[model samples]
Target: MLCEREKYDKISEESNRKTGDDMKIIVSGAKGQLGYDVIKRLEALGIQAVGVDLPELDITDADAVGAFVSREKPDGFIHCAAYTAVDAAETEKELCSSVNEKGTLNVARACQKNACKLIYISTDYVFSGEGEEEFETDSPKAPCNHYGASKLAGEIAASENCDKCFIVRISWVFGVNGKNFVRTMLRLSETKDELTVVCDQVGSPTYTEDLAVLLCDMIKTEKYGVYHATNEGLCTWAEFAAEIMRLAGRKTKIIPVASSEYKTVAVRPLNSRMSKKSLDENGFSRLPAWQDALERYLGILNEC
Candidate 1:
């Protein structure tokens, strides 16, 4: 018998599409990588967008969040703000929880009050790094580290507080506006002739530019729920490092090392392979292959 994938209720065609010059959307973490691309994309599409970040907005402050939302009165809010330092999260558990969970709750409440569509960006770390099988949207969440646990809590906070929220899980994201693996690899190649990278962990790399396009598409429709979004292919860290060298014409060699050889403050998930059936079913398009994305990324770097 075929293993049946549990399906989610299909997104109906009843779209409360946001249009016109007066249309507005607010983006959290607008200074970050994904948010930068998203705001750029929105402007390209002729949509009015406002970004909130840094000293102007502290999401953990309920009053600030509420006032901001009330003032903007946006049709949609894309929440990309997060405490992303993986290893640091282990020691800074309290801060991580406050930002990822409490901050998210504040945002969700604000969104609910404004009747705004919320998009909460999450990570694949919520799963244990056990097997090689791809993780489904409804996969059991057994986060092994503090960071993962906090993010999982954030997911719950966002979903529970806001009825019109989209929980989008992504992994290995790279982009032009912020620091990412591609830039790090290229920087390392400038000095080192060889590098040892972790080979055990494998996942797809998400290009923020591509992801931003998909997000814009989602904000247009009211099909809000949980989903996974990433580039179309997968690779180990070592393989990805080697590809970076190849693209940039660097002679740096990549040596594959097991997870045990590399020590970190926090545990990492090995099985970050997420199934995109949800996106396909929800009438969303998958991102381009990682290899294609990497090449374009390097090209962009070269021009810069």
Candidate 2:
């Protein structure tokens, strides 16, 4: 097997030869689940990536963002930084808006100034969470919570500020680098014999590793527009927990319950089914099924 540095050189050389473009990229929120995976993917492709997070690079500070972008002058900018505390955003609306909206605007503006392609990571919460049919890329947005509203505002800011921008919305995300549903389920099962999960709310679970690769692929092309990218297929939170227990060989029973049974500070969307037709029409590679992603994630977790 090739060493890390050797793998990086091989991938980077091949990417450069094929694309004929230097792969210099900047990733915000570099320590986050998605951002960390994205940087790893870029490095595997032998691309030059600079990862920035809070304290190092504050996205809410326009001058700081501008200075950093000007200094780096990367070919692409992946804006993964955001205030993602869904429930806390209800009371901390200003902090959420400042990070998700104003912070995104600052990054978008920097991309515009530096002539860099922008890839802004968004969320499925932007929808109203009431429909049965899958939401199209142009579906009307009516965010039901402050977190969702803030993210939607960020999306709008990205579009308005940058000409070459791609807004990729994901749902039910899980990764090794951060707290997610899979980890939570495993932890709960350790302490409890049974758990109640909402069956009414449905959405796809997106593995950050898969999403990172897709984001890298998007930056390679000029398919600059809104797109819905998530692991294929959908299931309720109860169903998801059941699968987790099944894979882990845990005997914890998952009781199905309505969304009302579990009250949260913010309302979750009932339907997070987003159509990937835009990805197909735009000639982008679609992600594998959620089951496959789950299994892969579990395998990785076990090894760790």
Candidate 3:
């Protein structure tokens, strides 16, 4: 397995050489888990990246988006802003739609007006919870929940509105800058002697830090289309929790349960397996295994 330093070096060398110096990129939702890491990665490569979120840049406002893009005049725009609260989205349908659908349209329009390439971050929820086969980039979307439906709308908007757009879908994302499963598990471990996680919900756990590197690399090329990006292995939520406990050297027993055991406002996909064929075919490097990513993430958590 390549160490984090080696991975960074490889990506930096390849992307910087391809993109060259002084390439300005605009990143929306800069404070998001993926966006934070992307900005850091770009900075490491000596690239000029401008990150915006909330009050500074309301993606839902078309005029605000157009003004920002016109002022920045960036070469590429990474649209990471989205209403990501899965369960909350069920009750807040309008808010979710406004951000994920209309907000994305606004960003796409801005990108088109500025002649900027767009890299939109998407999710695995777009697929229906069916079959064991990996969902390809072109797989038909059947959203199981409000969050998924809204994201699918965003994907469509980005594709239709922008001439140069790369819609990259990720699954089970965990990062330092946002609330995620990993952090929740660790927090729960502190108070609870045991925990129950869903075993039927299976997907790849993507580390935002690893994903950020891939996004930075993808923006340098013109391979505009849909792509599925996640760590190379698959596991259920139960298995993921077990690994996290094992790495942290915690003795908290992890109890496995079916999706029916836990009730939520929104439904989750049972199978979120996605194929990375597009990444390989397009000559982009795939992320490391989930285990490796977990270990590295744990090390970072320890430091914090």
- Name the best candidate (by lDDT): 3
lDDT of each: 0.87, 0.91, 0.92
Per residue, candidate 2 scores C-alpha lDDT tens digits across 126-202 of 99988799999899999999999999999999999999999999999999999999999999999999999999999
Cα lDDT for residue 8, model 3? 55
lDDT for residue 139 in candidate 2, whole number 0-100: 93
For model 1, residues 1-304, the per-residue Cα lDDT tens digits are 3111101101111222322334688999999999999999788777788988988999999999999999989989999998899999998999999999999999999999999999999999998868999999899999989989999999999999999999999999899989988889999999999899999999999999888877877887788889999888889989999999997999999999998999899988887899998998987867778888788788888898
Candidate 2 accuracy as lDDT: 0.91
Residue pairs whose backbone atoms clash in candidate 3? none
TM-score of the candidate numbered 3?
0.97
Off by over 4 Å in 3: 1-8
**Which residue pairs does candidate 1 place in steric collision?**
none
Ranking of candidates on lDDT, top first = 3, 2, 1
- What number of clashing residue pairs does each candidate have, in the order they appear? 0, 1, 0
lDDT of 3 by residue, 40-138 (tens): 988987889999999888999999999989999999999888999999999999999999999999999999988999998999999997999889888
Cα lDDT of candidate 1 equals: 0.87
Whole-model alpha-carbon lDDT for candidate 3: 0.92
Cα RMSD (Å) between model 3 and the true structure?
Answer: 1.3
- Who is ahead in lDDT, 1 or 3? 3
191 Cα displacement, candidate 1 (Å): 0.7
